[model samples]
Target: MSQQTKSDYVDDVDVDDDWDDHPTDDELEATVENLEASGFDVEVVSDAEEALDVLVSEIPAGASVMNGHSTTLEEIGFDDYLGEGDHDWENLAADIWSIDDDAERDAARRAAQTADYFLGSVNGIAQDGTLVAADLSGSRVGAYPFAAQNLLLVAGVNKVVEDVEAARERLHEFAYAFENERAQEAYGVESYPSKELVYRQEGTEGRTTVVLVEETLGY
Candidate 1:
């Protein structure tokens, strides 16, 4: 058998060709209105790099920050910046993983959920302003409900679907497969969406912020 190489799994691998679909202007306007009406603050960014710049300004200095596993986050350079950038915020994920002991690492992960800022990406966004996401484990989505002090979700405009049913299909058609590819490459195992989270509404006035990028990015 040929030896498996990073290039074989990641470089030349085929990704789904569904980005040809672009939402109309009416669709974008309505989706943004619906998202805001649903009580979540929404900001539309022009491109991935611009999204990164805006995100940095949005996060407060010296805040404790924790982020979930998200391709979008990596796409926008958050993963690299947060890990290596000389910033005032505490890198909770780095701190958690640095613990050599497995039990202590797990405990740190749980505690990090309550960080001042919890950043992540969502799989789907319904035109009605609903946010949909899933996780292989509860560690990621677990803090969105009420634990984290603040939440930041960055997604591409392509993730905006017609409705909740379409959102589910979006997950099955794109998010799951893309994530599985990443998991297989990184861990040598497949991944499934075991836990689901539908953010229907945000009761707090400014607790949740949604950054929507115009360019096609992530799954």
Candidate 2:
């Protein structure tokens, strides 16, 4: 995964008119520092492999792990890893999807909100250290505020924005569109942000960890 400049994603990053402008290395450094200062433990990795390694080693072997629909995770091979990789932790998503009954499957998905570890991605991250995410339902973001014991978010650097407002714009312009397209194809309906979560600051120490990768991943 190359550290593509903002120019590379000129057509895709629609956080706003100027939101597509990618930050420089200095801006990235500042963003990391700002993120850490705001109480989010941050990890700066160069590529998807490093990001996967971080997830594999940081999460305990037997700690129940779960994740939602994330293209970034898919791109990094995490979906397959959680399903097929040798590990001791329970993969809740697999469990939720395995149920033969639709009603039971929906229940399991809700139950997963309390998993030992909840993993997901964000729509955008602000330089001020705020995280912005949206979903058709609150199933994923619902765990971030209080449901999960520990939370891990894997995001590509392309998500970093200049400010909180830009973060929201990115979600509306880019993330929502990308997801709506996927939803229409997958479920025969368009998707919108039925539920939104803005992670302000984590009060607990070491409870929420964010892995920031340098490559262009996700919407």
C-alpha lDDT score of every prediction, in listed order: 0.83, 0.83
For candidate 2, the clash count comes to 1
lDDT string for model 2 (180-214, tens) is: 76666567897889898889899888989999999
lDDT of 1 at 27: 95
Candidate 1 wrongly placed segments (more than 4 Å): 1-16
- Candidate 2 Cα errors over 4 Å, as ranges: 1-21
Clashing pairs in 2: 15-170
lDDT by residue for model 1 over 1-219, one digit each (tens)?
222322233443454556325578899899999999999999999998988887788888999999988878887888889988678899999899789999999999999989999999888889999988898887889989888999999988988888888777777766777677777767789888889888899999999999999977666
Residue 60 error for model 1, in Å?
Answer: 1.3
Question: What lDDT score goes with residue 17 in model 1?
Answer: 54
In order of appearance, the predictions have TM-scores of 0.91, 0.89
